[model samples]
Structure formats: structure tokens, C-alpha cells
Target chain A: MQFIVEDVVTHLAVKVTEPRIDAAIATPFKDKLREIVVKSRKPIHLDMASVDFMDSSGLGAMIAVRKSLPQNLGMVLCALTPNVERVFRLTRMDSVFDIRPLTAQKEHRE
Target chain B: MTPIERSEPKRSTRASAQVQPMFHRVLSAQPETVRDTLQDVRRRFQGEVSDDTLGRLELVLAEVMNNVAEHAPAGAGAPDDSVRLPVIHLCIVRHTNGLACALTDDGVSLPDECILPRSLPALVMDDLPEGGFGWFLIQDLTQALCYYRESQRNYLAFSIPFAQSGAA
Candidate 1:
């Protein structure tokens, strides 16, 4: 349930530190991410590199956060593990959000 | 007896045999416990099953178990001191083709629509759906999905097939 937000100028780069986002943390996870994105009011670049697993509830949370933002604002999901990515791909939510491959930043960071 | 008939008896007795990698648990229908069981199930069959199959297996189990937890009987759960968490009995056994799973729970009866063939929820971008994907995902990834209610408990069974190797 921890997020590391960095203001990368054009977009707010937010990294999810949690390994799994399931029913256990979906509500709080949504609430926290919603607050962060709403306050910043910038397009988001979400780093899902640490997350190894996510269920439908977790996907719902991500969708809720995306819906919370202004229509013009964007959220790009990156570095999704295979398990986490399947939920999005199977549900066809991958079409709704901007998904990117793992960036060089992840390799640089500890 | 044919070879198939010879092995059928042995495989049916998998519960008592150590040859098959199996998992069985009696846990309350709660988010935390369900999560724990999934992790352990993954560990129990880590190298035995491919990662692709394991991922599918985990996601499907999460949806079914959490659905039970979410629909806990009215006045039966949460902050109240007299809380009675629905108890779920889960079992998984690996076969040549796929992993077979069966779950029985004392939670509220499952709706008829769940086991029926279902499509994904309609996509609305402006007001994107936040839910309703659970059952669809469950049905989409499982085979021979079946459900029946007997007296006070609901029984569910399904299988996740092994991954098709080296398919590009």
C-alpha cells in the first residue's frame, strides 16, 4: 500500500511498492492513489514493476483511479509483471490505459 | 483392464497418495486468508506447473474465494462481536491435463448467473466499470466450471489447463 511519487516534470511518476494488490488492499489502494492523482492534477506514469500479482478487484481499483482523474488527464501503466498483466489483457482493460514496457529507470534504481 | 482403467483408480485415490502435488485447506472466507492460501498453493506446485498456468490458477482462485467473502451472509461478519465468518473448504489436485479445483463454502448461495456463460461487462470510458469483471474472469479462465447448492453449502468445481508450450 505504499507509493513513491516523483514529479518528473511532464508527468507525475508514481511507483507502486506493493507486491500484490488484491481484495485485501483494493479499497485503500484506490483511495490512496485517487488522492495522489487528484491533488497533483497531472498526467500519471504508474510504475507497476514491483507488483507480481493483481486480481479483478485490483484491476477495479486501477480503473476507479483512472476514472477519478479528468478526462484529459492520462495514466500510463508500466513494467507490469506477467501475472498482473494477464488480468488487464484478459479483461481488455489494456485498451483503456496507456501501458508501457519496463523503463530504464527501474534498472537504475535499487 | 486397459491402461486408462488401471490408472483411474490410482488417480482417484490422490487424496491419500503422495505422488500427486495436492493442496487442501479449511479457511474462513476472508480476504487475508484467501490471499495466504493462494500464495501457498503457488508454492506447492511451483516447478510442477508452468508459470503461465500458475498465474491463471491464482487469479481464478482469488476471484472465487473473494466473491464468497464479499457476499458473506447478512449480519454474519465484520465489526460486530458476534461475527461469524463464512468457512470455505478448498482443494486442488494436479492431473496430466490441468489443475482441478473444488471449493465448498457456507456463505450466501451463489447466484445462478455466475456459472452460466458470461461476457465481459460493457466498456464505458467516461464512467468505466469498477467491478463485474470477477465472475467473467473466473469463467473465462476455467474449464468445466460447475456449481451446485446442497442444503447449507455451495459447491464449485473447475480446472485450469496446462500452458501450451512454446507457442508464439
Candidate 2:
């Protein structure tokens, strides 16, 4: 899986285009996220609209990215597809992250 | 040609019953091909599966096929050096109560240390997110799941209760 990082205002938006985010491809995705966070400003938004599947591996990577951000300035938000959203709901991680609708302003900002 | 005499042999054959018909198929390991194969299976079965069961079947099949593409050994110049082209072996068995599916592939077996936990909390807390949950979900959704390794092949089997209790 490859994640494309785009800088929107001061916040970084990361888009995951892969359909499956499980153990098989988690490491590459996490590595790319780490690379992006190191150079990003603050308030990262993860656009998971194209991601149809996410297992624990993907969730762990998201959490790791959240933790790697600057403590005071870092915020992580999720834009989940309906199917992927179900996974978040099932795992109750929706409560931890600032999950917004796919079409919400934060997600639509390109 | 008496009606009673002719029907007696037919009735006895039905009662004795030969071996149940078995179905098997092998398909390419491409991700796109997986969906087509699934659709074909559903069509061939004539919508025998309820909606809920169909959803579960799709999820489980996707999980296993994804694993095959990621973990199996790859041949030279394979699309992704990740795994050689995987040979997926699928078998469906019909029993009195339900249908059983056994999917076999030439991929690495589940790691010895990665036994699925018996409880959901253990799965949520002990397993780090972004990994180690596919098998857990498969176990939770299916009626039964088992894994075995023989020679160089990995066999994963799962079954669902098919006798309809009510509408899905």
C-alpha cells in the first residue's frame, strides 16, 4: 500500500489508495506515514476513503502515526469509507480518533 | 410397467443415497479475479446462501485470498516479488446441517506464536492494531476455524451453519 501525502494549509492530509491494509502491507504504509510526519507541520488528517479494508495492522499504523506527531501540536483525524468505517466502529477506535464523514470539510479540502 | 413396481426401485435408490456430489475449483490469485469467482460460486449455488451468510463468506474469502497474494512464494518476474503466483485450491463440502469450505494454498502457515485468543478483549488489547486481526475476525465470524500445515502447503478450513432458522 502507498500513501500520498498532501499539505493542506498547515495540516497534512494522507490518503491511502490501497484496498487492503493488513499485516501484509502494514509495514510499508507505516514507514511512509513516519516519513510524512517527520516533515509535516501539525494536525494530520488521514483520508481513508479508498481503503475498503483495514485490519488491526492498519489500525496500529494509524495509532503509531498519531503518537509520533509533536505532542502539543499534533492532532489526528480520520476520514473513513463506509466499509472501513464499519471496521473502526467494530473496534471502537472511532471513539479515540476525530472521525468525520467522508464529505466533511476536513476531508474535502484535497 | 406397473406404477407401484417401477416406483419401488426409484424409492430404494433415493433411500440408499450415493456419495454427495463434491465441487472443487482452482483459480488465479489476482485480487480482481477473486470477486468474479465469488460471484460465480454464488450464482452456481442458486442463491442458497442468505444475505448475512453471503456477507460473511465474502469477508472470509477476501481475507484468505489476500493472505495468499501477500505470503505465498513468488515465481520469477511475478507482478510483485511479494509472492510467486499462488495456486489457490478451494473445496466445498455439503453436510447434513451445513456447508464446509476448505481453502488451501502454498503459503507460509500461521506463525506458531500467533494462536487466536479465545476472548475479544485479548484480541483488542493484546494485539497491536494494524496487524494480527484478520484471523481473529475470521475466527469470530465463522462457526469453526482450523489451520494445519502438511509438507509445504497451508490448509485453512472454516464452516457455517446453513440450516435456515429464519430469514437472514
Candidate 3:
């Protein structure tokens, strides 16, 4: 249950390094996300590029985390692998959450 | 104007055994073991089926096995501290049409409903659904998904077509 957090201009991007997020780490993952969500009022971006698989519990955990946040703050998912994306699509969660492609931002030309 | 004689599309005529030998393995009903078992199952069928089929199989297996580990008790009315770990038996076979999987667990049986939901519930912000999506995903991706309780054991079987076609 390791995540590498990156600071973006308007949000914090957390990259889940685990290949799979199933029942084993669902609860702990939710707790960790809660801690981060509460600490920062800015929007959060979950980078799931490395997560090739996510079962029901993992999907549930994500939903729980999103619900725990204050209404003002926001959470978005990005860079989901094809397999993981299917779960979201099949469950109709792609419409519920703000999902972005891997190329969410372009390099700053400063 | 000329009419072209069209040849019929060839259908798969390979025997089940020639495609892939039936895979069977028993594992302790634990989250870690279930995850490992799914990985092994995926590896075994990687080259045999399309990636989409493999992904569906992996998702279904994970949901079922994890449900067992999380909710199924070792014995009926057994004390939590004294309860023993249960075992799950998994079998997979490749048919011409698709892949079939059967899983058996000696843990507690499903609720009286004994059936999966027909569709996923709406994900509303006021009342979020943390769980209950497992069975929906399984039912959406599989064919002939059935469950039976007999002799104090839970048996589940389902099939995933090699092609991308599905009810959901």
C-alpha cells in the first residue's frame, strides 16, 4: 500500500505503486486517503497508472474515500489501466467520478 | 451483375482437452492467498485466451474468492477465536466458446437471497455504495453465473466468452 504523492498546481497527485488493489489493502488504502484528503483542501488526483487490477473492495474503497471528503474539495481519478478502467465502466462509475486521461497536463513552458 | 459464391466462416472445432488441460488447485481462504491464486490462474491462461477474457476471469475470481475470505466463516456457529481457516477449491477449463470456472468453499453459505443483483446501483454522493459492486461486475461479465448450496458447501460456476460480447 505505497503511494508516491506529487504536488501539482491545484491538487496533489497520488500515484499508487501497487500492481493490484484488492481486499488485502482496501481498508488501509481508504484510511490513508482519508488522512490526505482531510489535510488538504485542494483537489486530489489519484494516478492509477501502475494499478493493473482493482477488485470490488478496491473500487468500494475509492468510493468511500470520495464520500468522506468535504463537498467543497474534489477528487479525480487519472491514468487507469485498461483492465481497471473496465471495472469503472462496467459499474457505471466512469460517469460518477471525474476521470482523466494519463496526459492530464502538459509540460509548463516556463 | 454477378453474385459471388461466399464461403462459410470456419468455426472452432478443437477439442477441449487439446486446447488446455483443466486447471485445479485448492487454496487457503485468505485475501493474500486469493490474490496469489488469481495471479497464477491468469498466468496459466495468458496465452490461451484473449487479454479481455483473462481480465474478466481475473475480476470474477478475485471477487468470489475475496467474498469467501471476508464473509464466510470456517464453520456454522463456530466461535470466532476457535474457528479454523477454510479452503477454497478452484477449477478452470477452456471450451471452444469460452472459459469456464468452478469454485467451491467449505465456509458459510450465501444469504437466503442466494442470487446476485441484476444491475449495479446508482453511485450517489449522498449515500455512497462502498460494496455490493462485486456481484454486479461478476454478473455483468459472465454467462450462466449460478450458485448452489449443498452439503454445507458453496459452489459457484460461470463462463466468460473469448470474444468481447457480454450482457453488460
Candidate 4:
């Protein structure tokens, strides 16, 4: 459940430091993400490059966090590994979130 | 009920005549123990299978085992090594096209029969669901899945192909 938050140009970017996001860490992951999301009016960007695996619980936690956000505030997910990306695709979550490729050096949301 | 054997694959010439299938059994209601067993199983299949296959295996096992850990009541004297631990038995057998896995747990049965959704609900942004994705995810990841209850045990059997494929 380790993450680092950075204030990007207009959005707040949170990079998850964990290699695996599953049932074991989903609750804490949600809590930490919610804390950050609640304080920021800017949109949120989640950098998931270090996450190699994510299970249903982790996916649910992400959804929960997204739901807790204000309607005008947006959320984006970036750099999902193939393993983690597969879960997003399997659950059709790819369509719900703004997913970006690993090589996207910079993303700006207006 | 008897297990189903669908399209058993011929043994590869490189495989030994006596290479046994992989199996792991543990008696614990703790989720961490179940997670550890999954890591052990992944190591057991490390080079023999594709990463996609292993990921699917891990996903399905985690979902089911977590369900067991969260819901199953501690049975009386089922654990010899650790008293009051629930038992989970997993067996994986290689098939011609993929792998067949079965998970057995001494836990409570599904409330109104084993009814798992075959597909996920539509993802509407405003009214999205936070939970109820476990069984749907399981169904989407596996080639086939079956659930049954007998003799006070819950059995879930599924198949995983060595391809990067799943239902959305």
C-alpha cells in the first residue's frame, strides 16, 4: 500500500509503489487513495507502472475511489502492465477509465 | 459427482512418463496463507506455462480462496497442525489444450444454489458497482467453470488455457 503523490501541472498524480494490488492490500489502497482524492479539486492520475498484478478486490477499490470523487473531477490510469491490463479488459474497466500507454511521457488534462 | 474430463491432451514427448500433476493442500482460514499457497503454485508452474496462464490461475484462486477465508466457518478438529483452521484443497492437471483445476473447501454453501453470472453488468459511470465482480471475473477468465456442494463441501472446478484470452 505504498504510493507517492505529486502535483502535476493541473492534475494530482499518485504513483503506486507496490508490485501487487490484490485482496491483501485493497482496503488500505482504497483508504489512501480516497484521502488524496478527497482533498484535491484537480483531476487525479494514477501511475501503475510498478503494479504487475491486480485482482478483483483491487479493481473494486479503484472503482470505489472513482465513485467517491466529485462529478467534475476526472481520474485516469496509466502504464498498466500486460497482466494488470488484462484484468481491466476482462472486467470491461478499460472502457470506464481513461487508460494510457506506458510510453506516454506526459499527459495533460484541461 | 464425478469430475469431467474434457479433451485430455496427449502427453508431450518431452514429458516424463511419471510426471505427476501439481497439487497443494492447506488448512487455514487466513487470507495470507491462501495467498502464500498461490505464490507457491505460481512457482511450481513457472517455466512450464505462459505468464498469462499463471495470471489467470492466480486470479481465480485468489477470488475463490478469499471467498472461502471470508465466509467459511471454522470446522471442528479439521486441522491437525493448526487447530480450527478451514481446509482448502487444490489440484491442477494438465490437459491437451490447457489446465484443469479444482478447488475444494469445507465451507458454507451458496445461499440459493451456485448461481454465478456469466458476464459482467454494464459499466455505467454514475451507477457503477463496487462489488459482485468476483464470480463474473472468474467466469470470464476460465474456459469453463462449475460449482457444486455435497457432503458439506463446496467444490469449484475450472479450466485455464495457455492463451491470453478471457470474456469481458
Candidate 5:
């Protein structure tokens, strides 16, 4: 489990370097992410672009990390790959997490 | 979306017209092994199946095999408290309309409640459920999910339908 944590303008920006978050490493992923997010009292932006696969255990880990944070604080998952996004969407966890696309700019038609 | 088809015992698909890609592996019911097997499975059907169908197939297989790993009983005859992992026999074959999958293992018998109709865990914002999504995803993505215990081995079968032309 590797996360590149940086102090962005208002919150911690984390880049998840792992490609897969299945049962093999879900526990460690949760522990390490929780430690990083709770150390500072700010919002979080998790860049999940690199993760190509995630299962139910991985979903549980994400939920665990979200629950670990203070209720007032927020964690945003950004750039979720299709496979990873499917788990969240199937389980209805999409509503609970503040998911976002990578860029802030609007999509202008060609 | 495909309707759930009731599983037929000892049947995967009607006789196939063309030879399709197939994968078979016998591995321990451990997380690391499960990951490796799933990766290999993806490789076996990379060009043969669409991405949508492949993704669904992978997710369903992961949930089933990992359940075997997670619920493994303690080492049956070990002197020490070493955990004993079940051995999973997995087979997947491509059919004309879907991918047929079958898995057999001698592990803790699946409780009656697992295969019963299930819904997502109650979505309580303050105390969200951490688990219980595995079986739900399996049931949702696969068609004809059937499970039966014969003697000590548990037999399970299902099929993942090919993605519709433009149903998204």
C-alpha cells in the first residue's frame, strides 16, 4: 500500500499508487490510509485513477477509511477507473462518498 | 441487464459450436492466490471477450473464491493453531452468449442464508456496513447461480452474460 500524500490548497491530496485493492491487501490499505488521513484535520482527495481492479473487500476498506475520518471532514475519490467505480456503484456506496472527476473544467462540446 | 437464470446441476452450457477459450486452475484458497488466478483468467480471455463481460466475470469469480479463503476452517489436523486454507478448483469457459463458470471446494459449508435472495446492507450514513456486499454482487452480476453440497465438496456454478449492444 503506497500513497503519495501532499498538502494541497485546503486538504490532503493523495495519489494511490497501487493498481489493485483486493482481499490480499484491503486491511493494510485501510490501516495505512486511515493513519494518513486522520493525522491532519482536513479534507482528502484520493486520486484513484491507477487502480484497475477492486472487489468487495476493497470496497469495505474504503468504507472503513471513510468512517475513520471525522464526520465534519470530507474525503473525495477522484478519477475512479471503470472497474473500481463499478463496485462502488453496485453496492450503492457512490452516494456516501463525494466522488469527482479529475479535472475541474467543464466539458465543452466539440 | 440479464435476468437471473436458475442454475442447472452439472450443466454449464449447451454443446458449443465453436471451440472457445477456457481456463482451469487448482489453487489454495488464499488471497494472494486468488489475485493471481484472477489475473490469469483475465489474460486467458482478453481478446476473446468484451471488456464489460470480462470485468463482470472477474468480479464474480473474486467474490466466490475469496469467500472460500475468508471462511477457511482452522487446520483440521495440525498440532498448532495454523490456519488451513481450502483448495479451490475453478474452471471457466466461454459460450456463445455468456461465460460459464464453475468452482468446487471442500471448505466450511456455506450457510443457508448466503445463497438466499439478498439486498445491499442497510446504508446507514453514520455507521455504514463494512461487509455483506460480496454475495450480493455475485448474485447481481451472474446468471443461473446454483450451489449444492455433495458430501464434503461444495459445487457452485453460474454464467456471466455478454454485455448488451448498448444497454448502459
Candidate 6:
């Protein structure tokens, strides 16, 4: 799995190229995201279109990313594929983050 | 009058000697490869199980493999580095009436003090703030689940009962 990091104004958009975002791959991704959050001054958008599955560890990673950012300075957005979306819903994490549909417009226009 | 004596039937003590097909492999601990392996396992064992059973098995395997990949031993470089050598060992055993799987990794074992909470649904739904729900799910779904740490390896095993079609 590959993680592409892009900076957008005050917010950061991370594109995860992995097919699954469960426990096996969540740690490295979480660490990368945390590194990004520590350096960025804006919200973080996790684009997970390529992620077909996400278990609890993946969810925990997201939560950890959310916590790593400065309070009131960082927000977390998730764009999840259908299967991954199902997991988020199953875990009721759908209400925790700004979860965008996989088909939603990208954060950057260009 | 003639008396007739009868002997009590002897019960077999051994587990049914049914031929259980076994499939096992140690694959790259890459998150991207898990789905393909799962699909192959399902396809090969299709008619013998139900969709729900397959889904449960897949979920368990995914969680375990994901744990191995993310936490397995390797210098922190990239996700690919996690699968350097002997990082993951997975086995799927199917019997005439049950299915079992074990996934092992050479990563740091789960902490001894870190108790996997029972309130996973509450944690996920209510944002209760704690983690380790994957362990919970693995324990919840399978009939038998255990975690063993041997030296540097963490082994997670799970099994479920296989429903038989009819009586012989």
C-alpha cells in the first residue's frame, strides 16, 4: 500500500493507495498521517477510495490521527469506498468524522 | 424360559476420522495482497460453507493478517518492509464439520496488560476512546480463539463449527 500526501492551503489530503485499511496496514499509515498532522496547520482529509476493507485498527488509526492534531486546529475527513464505508457504519464511526462519499468531489479543484 | 443378555454399545472416543481438507500458506504481509488470498480461499472452499461462514472467516483472517503486517518486526521504513522474511504464516484447515485458521506474525505481541475490552460496539459507536476492538471481533465470531506468544512470534488461532447436510 502507498500513501500519497498532498498539502492544500491549511488542510492536508492523504490518498491511500492500499486496497485494505485494516489492522495489518493501519499502523504505518497512521504514523504517516500523524507525521503529516504534526507538520500541517489545517484539517486532514483521508481519501480512502482504494480502501476496500477497514477493521478496528484502521478506525483506531483514524482516531489516533484525530488526536495527534492540535485541538480546535485539526479536523478529520474520510472518503470511504462502499465496503470500507460498511465497516465504518458497522462500527458507528460514520458519525465521528466528516465522512464523504467516495464519489464526492476532491478537496482540491485542480 | 430363556434369558438373553445384551452388551452395551461402545462409544468411539476419537474425534470423527473425517477427511478434512487443509489449505495453508505463509504470504507476504502486504495489506493489498490479503483480499486476493481471501478470495482464493473462498473460491476453493465455496460449496462446503455458507456465505455467513465465509464472511466470518474472511473477517477473522483479515484482522489477524492486518495485525501482523502493521506490527510485525522490521525497521520502520515502508509497508513493504514489514514482509521482509517469515513475517506472516497463515493456515486454513477445513474438516468435514468445521473450519479453523491460524495467523502468526513475528511482530511485537499484544501487550500483556492491555485487556481487549468487551464493549467494542460501545467504543466504535459511542466514541468511547479506547481501542483493540479487532481482538474483540475475532473472539466474538469464532467458536474457539486464542493468542499465543512464542519468542518473537504472535500466533492467533480461530475455528468454527461446520454444519453438516444430513445424518449418515
Clashes of each: 0, 12, 0, 1, 0, 3
- Can you write out model 3's per-residue Cα lDDT over B1-168, one digit (the tens) per residue? 565546545447764226465679999788988988888888888888888889988998898888889875546235564776678999999987888899999888877443646667766768978877887887777888888989979998988878866344
The two-chain DockQ for each candidate, comma-separated, is: 0.88, 0.23, 0.71, 0.64, 0.87, 0.19
Each candidate: RMSD: 5.7, 7.5, 9.3, 7.3, 7.8, 10.8
Overall lDDT per candidate, in order of appearance: 0.90, 0.64, 0.82, 0.79, 0.90, 0.67
> Model 5's lDDT to the true fold?
0.90
For model 5, the DockQ equals 0.87
Task: Report the candidate with higher DockQ, 4 versus 5.
Answer: 5
lDDT tens digits, residue span B44-93, model 5: 99999989889989999999999999888866324674765688999998
Q: In model 1, how large is the Cα lDDT of residue B36?
A: 96
Query: For residues B1-168, could you state the per-residue lDDT of candidate 6 as single tens digits?
Result: 564445544546564445456677777666666667777777867777776566567776777676666664565446566536446777888865568887787767677533343545465432345375676666655665677899878887768656423311
B16-125: candidate 2 lDDT, tens digit per residue:
68555345789766555655666566555546656545545555666677666656554622667754566789887656656688988776676854345543333342
- Residue-level lDDT of model 1, residues B63-141, one tens digit each, is 9999999998666666864869889999999987999999999888998998888999999877789999999999888
Off by over 4 Å in 4: A103-110, B1-21, B74-85, B111-117, B164-168
Winner by TM-score between candidate 6 and candidate 4: 4
Q: What is the lDDT of candidate 6?
A: 0.67
Give fnat for candidates 1, 2 and onward, in order.
1.00, 0.30, 0.88, 0.73, 0.91, 0.24
CAPRI-style quality class for the chain A–B interface of candidate 4: medium
- Candidate 1, residue A34: CA error in Å? 0.4
TM-scores, all models, native as reference: 0.89, 0.58, 0.86, 0.83, 0.89, 0.54
TM-score of 4: 0.83
TM-score between model 5 and native: 0.89
Whichever of 1 and 3 has more TM-score, that candidate is 1
Interface RMSD of each: 0.5, 4.6, 0.9, 1.1, 0.4, 3.8
Ranked by lDDT, top first: 1, 5, 3, 4, 6, 2
lDDT of each residue in A3-106, candidate 6, tens digit only? 79888775778887877666556789788778777777777777776775667777788788777777666455566555565455555666776776543564
